[model samples]
Target: MLSKKTKYAFHALTYLGKHRDQKTVLIHDISEEYGISHKFLENILLELRKAGILGSKKGKGGGYYLIKEPKDVALSKVIRLLDGPIALLPCVSLNYYEPCAECKSEALCGLNKVMIQVRDEMLNVLENKSLADILDKE
Candidate 1:
């Protein structure tokens, strides 16, 4: 399940992507437009900025903006940044791999085998899809 934070981030990013030509967008404006809490949105945007996905200005004409092109930002990168590993099980995680305590061998584990397949399929879609692809759909 996607976290509320991740959903809000997506909404915010989509809004920015749609208005990429604009200099900046105020957090309050984004919150009001999407009915998201201002404080929560602020934190999400800050995180994105730190991740180099967004940039902000401090003064009157300042707000959040996308630092990278929408097509350059993969859905998988966003998901991994905000939600951690995409794999269903830690043992199958590519970046955040952890051996299952009960399992003696990952190669012999039935659950591990199934989870690897699941992770691969999920990655195929996520890694291929970008913010631009989603924006085009809309």
Candidate 2:
């Protein structure tokens, strides 16, 4: 399940990607246009900046821009940056795997099998969808 924070992050990024190479857009402007809180959006942007997905120039003309083109950024990457692992079950997650306390045999567990398939399918879809695809909706 996607968190509200992750959803908001994607929406903001999509809006920014569509306006890439244009003049810097202020946080207040984006917040007002998107119905998001400026402070919350700024924190989201900070995470993106630390992930190297976005760049910011401070001082006279400062805002946000993609560090890479929309096509170069996979939706999975963005989601992971904001939402962490895509898998619902931590045991099935590739990066953040942790066996549940109740689960004893992960090796032959049917639940693990189902979760693995689910995680793979989720990854395939998200990996195929890029920032370009998201922004192109408009």
Candidate 3:
């Protein structure tokens, strides 16, 4: 399941990307536009800034903007940042693999095998899809 936090981040980033060259957008403006809470958006922006996905300018006319182009921002990168590995089972995870507690055997586990396929499919979708691709889709 996609967390609200991640979906919100994607919405905000794509909004910023659309307006990247125009100028930065005020948090309040973005919040109202997206129907998100200002305070929540502020926190999300801070995380994005620290991640180098967003750059902020402080002052009277200050706001936020994307430091990287939309095309350069990978969906996998965002997913990893927001939700970590795309794997269903921890044991099938690439970055955080761990055997399932109830699973008596991983070698012949049908669930693990299916989960690995799920993870691969997820990677294929997210890894190949970029913010630019999504933007173009819109």
- Compared to the true structure, candidate 1 yields what TM-score? 0.95
Candidates sorted on lDDT, descending:
1, 3, 2
lDDT of each: 0.92, 0.85, 0.86
Rank order by TM-score, top first? 1, 2, 3
- Give all TM-scores, in the order shown: 0.95, 0.94, 0.90
The best candidate in terms of TM-score: 1
Assess the local accuracy of residue 51 in candidate 1 as a C-alpha lDDT between 0 and 100.
93
lDDT accuracy of residue 85 in candidate 2 = 89
Tens digits of per-residue lDDT for model 1 on 9-115?
99999999998889998999899999999999999999999999999999888899999999989998888888889999999999888988888998888999999
Q: Residue 46 deviation, candidate 1, in Å? A: 0.9
Candidate 1 vs candidate 3: the lDDT winner is 1
Model 2 C-alpha lDDT per residue in residues 19-102, reported as the tens digit of each score: 886766677777888899899999998898898888888877788877888888898887888888899898998878888889
Q: Residue 36 in candidate 2 has what lDDT? A: 93
What is the C-alpha RMSD, rounded to one decimal, of candidate 2?
1.1
Residues 71-127 of candidate 3 have per-residue lDDT tens digits of: 888898887777777798899999778888998999989988898899899889888
**Candidate 3 backbone collisions, by pair:** none
